[model samples]
Target: MIYKFCPAVLLLILSFSPGNLFFSETKNVKEIAKVIKTSSETNEEAIYNSLNSNQFALPQLESFKEALKGFYILKEKGLISKNILTLIDFSMSSNSKRLWVIDLTTNTILYNSLVAHGRNTGNEFATSFSNSPQSFKSSLGFYATGEIYSGKHGNSLKLDGLEKGINSNARERAVVIHGAEYVSNSFIQNNKRLGRSLGCPALPLELTDKIIQTIKDKSCLFIYFPSDSYKGASKLIS
Candidate 1:
């Protein structure tokens, strides 16, 4: 009787042992698959490029790429209705001070003119300031400072997180596209240096109005820089 009972007890203990317990292997497999799918969806080329590049080096190139990515994404998302006209590749020179208008739809270089930018002396970061004056002398960079006219000018295109401040307010800064005499090829030939603006992108006075009109309203205008921070922030270029 004792022997029979001992054998029965041993069999019962083995059945409940940790080694004999069956884990849900299928559940673990499903979880891993879900993680992979999520990673693939969010991993775009923009993210990879930004991560690999040096942040402080080659700011202009990075900025241009980002601007491109931004426009491309906007088109993809149906935010922009028209085709890109051009990608002006300027910003190569510390004293370059020019804007290149490219025909995005045709890949043609429409115009390359001398332009003026912010004084490299005051601030390396050409910031948009409120309380700044409006005249050419007062214009820090052709932008109006303050909250008085936050959403009143032009159509409010969403810059998303790219630019600071509101669209309406941006107009008050008077950052409209314009031209300048100093930005002409003649000026470059004579002076051997591109002109500088307070902060507004002043183009050749000859082409300023036309370029403004062409890119006014709903068109996209990208100002490129080579900062690593900009590259990481934009989605247009990889």
Candidate 2:
């Protein structure tokens, strides 16, 4: 007679039989996990102070800090390389300059400019989001910036979403950072809001080059929205 082991039991046996096979980071994982757990609480006042000092809008600081927690966890997991962080506040109205690129290492804001959401997201605000291709809706979560390419939108930067089930399909959707004529004050004046993209984070034509160069190649980008689904399901956040 042969004794058969259950899958769960086998997994438990393998976990104990490993030299750091079950968890790669080992001791560092605990430190990182602690940071993530206290992120919202420990970071609130300090992040708000920094945002105020930097002249970043106080209303957006909460979302910024929330996004930073995920970024920190991703960094600790060896997901992103550069200390450059990009943020998109989809909760803001379409006309607001809601995109920010910051150097986390130097604590400097590199760019804060108007970026368009998907055409179908909303008229002046983005509420609906998706990870499906052709949904033409912006997906919320952490992303890693990829290589640059010159396409029909001129110079553009590719983005790879890091989170599963939320924004993992970003690359397949062709959702990229590209320049657009409509992401300007003139367009906003004409239409009462900035022109939206095909789910791409469309930037101003003039600044795409500089922004792309700074954040390209494995940098982190976090598209934030106050959705309950994302907040509950995201693995990078506590």
Instruction: For candidate 2, write residues 128-233 as lDDT tens digits.
Output: 9888889888888899999999999998999898989888998899999999999999999999999989999999999999999999999999998888888899
- Give the Cα-based TM-score of candidate 2 against the true structure: 0.80
Per residue, candidate 1 scores C-alpha lDDT tens digits across 1-238 of: 1222233344544445354344744554465456544443343233324432222222244444455556656565655545443233344552443355544565444565555555541222333322233433212111111111123322222221224321223344555445566666676677666665644556666665555545543445566544454345434443
TM-score of each: 0.50, 0.80
Clashing pairs in 2: none
Of candidate 2, the 10-residue stretch with the lowest lDDT total is 1-10
Look at candidate 2 and tell me the lDDT of residue 45.
50
TM-score of 1: 0.50
Instruction: Give lDDT for model 1.
Output: 0.43
Total backbone collisions for each predicted model: 27, 0
| Residue 14 displacement in candidate 2 (angstroms) | 35
Q: Identify the runs in model 1 with alpha carbons over 4 angstroms from their true place.
A: 1-64, 77-79, 85-90, 94-98, 120-162, 165-169, 189-191, 232-238
The local lDDT score (0 to 100) that residue 140 gets in candidate 1 is 18
The lDDT of each candidate is 0.43, 0.82
